[model samples]
Target: MPELPEVETVRKGLEQLVLNKKIKEVLVAWDRIIERPNIEDFTNQLIGEKIDSVSRRGKYLIFHLTHYDMISHLRMEGKFDYVQPDTSVTKHTHVRFIFTDHTELRYLDVRKFGRLTLLPKNTAMDYKGIKKLGPEPTPEEFLLESFNQQLKKHHKAIKPLLLDQTLITGLGNIYVDEALFKAKIHPEQTANTLTFDEVTRLHVAIINVLAQAVEAGGTTIRSYKNALGEAGTFQVNLMVYGKTGEPCPNCGTEITKIKVAQRGTHFCSLCQRIHL
Candidate 1:
């Protein structure tokens, strides 16, 4: 799944590639990928619409068109490519937005899990998944005080609590492990038990780690690529997410992997000691 940073990268790429391109035609090879307005309505309504801009919230992409907002979620295996009209269509290609300029923006998903929904103008933010998201993991939005308050109310394991997207948005398994390791907090630590100092460290770590990941264009784990079809470079900067049995960067302790809430978790046991 493309996490926040990966989605953000895609938004930037789309902004560069597809902005202001009037849709001359929309082809849907797979009907189920359109989640709103019925296939016929969706295809008809977007006929003359121009892509004004592209924005993002959490892992969702918002394509601001001339008359409506198209909400896109690139669930696992979903990707977009801008190409010529004569480009060969692959078996996984699902949606195509051919522009008046003769260029084409195609969406392909091997797993067919991605979704595209069309809604009224300026109403994309009200969508249920986006409306309920926690603030973007930035210093300005994810404040320390609110995060501290939220942490005190959760008794679940810290890793799962963070992954819930209620405490903070944009953190998937990869960034969570990296942030916890950077904060020196164990994955299994109870949320409410974190001391004030620990919480402060975690707050800074989350913001910094995510910022770095975004700067690096997100981690390219598996087959993730931005709309430009470029793989991310942050995977090489990863400290603990997939460094199992490797020596910790700070201390020489070997990293360990465990299952928390059925998700694979990685951390350095000596670096991230459990509070209990």
Candidate 2:
């Protein structure tokens, strides 16, 4: 699934490619991807609206139009591509945004887990999914005390707590484990038991790791790609994620994998000391 960095990359790409383009029509090859007031209503609302700008809130791609906001989530395999008027649509191509300029914005998803929501432009914050997200994980919002407060309220394993989109948005399995490993904190550690220093480290790690991932365009773990159909370059700079049984960067001990919150977690046993 595409996480924060991946979604943000797509948002930026879309902003550049589609802004100022008016939607000539919307064709929904998969109606189930439309999670709003129904495909017909959504299509009618967005038909002639101009795409003003594109941004991201949590993991959803926010496309601000002249009259409404079209938010789309690339749940798993969903991707957007800009194709010429003569380009042929492929098998998994589910949604197409035909532009007045003779170009088309195609949405392709092999897993069919994507979602699209259309809401009023001025009321975008009132949208249910966007309304529930926590603060963005930028430098200004990652205070140590605030992070500690949220963690102390959770008795669940740290990894699972971090994966909760309600607690702090834009984190999924990949980045949670990566952030934990970078902080030298074990994935299975109880959230409530984190020491003050551990909390501080974690707060910093989340911001640093995510920022770095965005810079690299996001981890090209599998199917994730930018609007240009290019793979992200962050996978090469990873420390421990998907590197099970490999030597740890900080210590010579091999990294291990275990199930935390039913998600495969990677950590360096020697470096991420338990009960520290």
Candidate 3:
């Protein structure tokens, strides 16, 4: 799944490439990708809608059109490619948005798990998935006091609680592991057991880790790439997400991998200790 940073990267790329380009036509090779309205209605309604801007909430991308807000979720292997009209449409290409300028924004998903929903203009935030999001992982929106209070209400293991997107949105398995590692909190630690000092460290860690990842264009894991067809560079700076046996950067201890809430989790045993 493309988390906030990856989704934000795609939003920025789309803003530059597709803004103000009126929709000449929309082609859907896979009908299941359109989640809202009938396929015929979706393709027909977008015929003259111009791409005004692109925004992101959590892992969802919102394309602000002239008459509607198109919410897209790139579930697993979904991605968009901006190309010319003559560009070859691959077997994986499921949705194609042909612009009046002759350029194309093609959505390709190997797993076919992506979805698109068109709602009234300015109503994208009220969508169920986006409505429940905690907040963007930033200092301005994600405050320490509120986070501490939320932690006190959850006895769930910290990792899964964070992954739930109700505590702090935008943290997937990768960034969650990294943030916990930076805070020196074990993934299995109960959320309510955390000390205020610990929570403070975690609060800062989440914001910093996500900000840095966004700056680096998000971590390129597996098939993830921005709309510009560029892979992210943050994977190179990762400490322990995929490093099972590597030396821990801070303590020289070998990193460990374990399953928490059925998600693969990585942390340094010496650095991150369980509080349970």
What TM-score, computed on C-alpha atoms, does each candidate reach? 0.98, 0.97, 0.98
Worst 10 residues of 1 by lDDT: 76-85
User: What is candidate 1's local distance difference test score?
Assistant: 0.93
The C-alpha local distance difference test score for the whole of candidate 3 amounts to 0.93
* Residue pairs with backbone atoms closer than 3 Å in model 2 (clashes): none
Ranking by lDDT: 3, 1, 2
lDDT for 209 (candidate 3)? 95
User: Which order, best to worst by TM-score?
Assistant: 3, 1, 2
Candidate 3 lDDT over 146-199, as tens digits, reads 999999998789999999998789999999999999999999999999999999
| lDDT (tens digit, per residue) of candidate 1 on 50-76 | 999999898899999999999999988
lDDT (C-alpha, whole model) for all candidates = 0.93, 0.86, 0.93
For candidate 2, which ten residues in a row score worst on lDDT?
Answer: 139-148
Give the number of colliding residue pairs in candidate 2: 0
Off by over 4 Å in 3: none
Clashing pairs in 3: none
Q: Where does model 1 exceed 4 Å of error? A: none
